[model samples]
Target: MNYSIKVTGLKYTMTIISATELQKNRIKKLVDLLKQCENINQQIENLME
Candidate 1:
């Protein structure tokens, strides 16, 4: 999986995040999101073909 974030008007801060950290927080939720994305991708591919 990939992670990215964007924001504006933010003060300097120290932050740390990695895939392992993310999964540890909510692995089930993340897995469900990934599955949903995969299903959508497959549907789009079917339409194109």
Candidate 2:
């Protein structure tokens, strides 16, 4: 019974860790997209000038 409880706890911890990692990856992607957008905007401004 104790062994089963330990296994359940470990699985729960792993799920939480993976969820956070997924969120981090999503945030990184968003940041990269923002940077790309900024670069595009700068190029547009230069073209207009």
Candidate 3:
């Protein structure tokens, strides 16, 4: 099974995917990790600007 999670921010958006059942059960952790990734991406964008 495939699970899609959408995380949206003021200047960025991301889609997280889980391809395994084990990962599906860790959605909350995945979301948190995605949030961290989004923050890092935002910081990179800021540095580039």
How close is every model to the real structure, measured as TM-score?
0.49, 0.60, 0.49
Query: What range of 10 consecutive residues in model 1 has the weakest lDDT sum?
Result: 5-14
Please provide, for model 1 over 1-49, each residue's C-alpha lDDT reduced to its tens digit, 9 standing for 90 to 100. 4333222322223233555755555855655565666667777879999
Top lDDT prediction, candidate number: 3
Candidate 3, lDDT over the whole model: 0.60
Candidate 3 deviant stretches above 4 angstroms? 1-25
Which window of ten consecutive residues has the lowest lDDT sum in model 2?
Answer: 1-10
Task: For candidate 2, report its TM-score.
Answer: 0.60
- Tens-digit lDDT track of model 2 for 3-49: 11122123211122344667767756655665566667777879999
Candidate 3 versus truth, CA RMSD in Å, comes to 6.7
lDDT by candidate, in order shown: 0.52, 0.49, 0.60
Best-fitting candidate, measured by TM-score?
2
Between the candidate structures 1 and 2, which one is better when assessed by TM-score? 2
Models ranked on lDDT: 3, 1, 2
Query: Tens digit of lDDT per residue, candidate 3, span 1-49?
Result: 3334434444333344544666555765766787788778778889999
| Angstrom error at residue 19, model 2 | 7.4
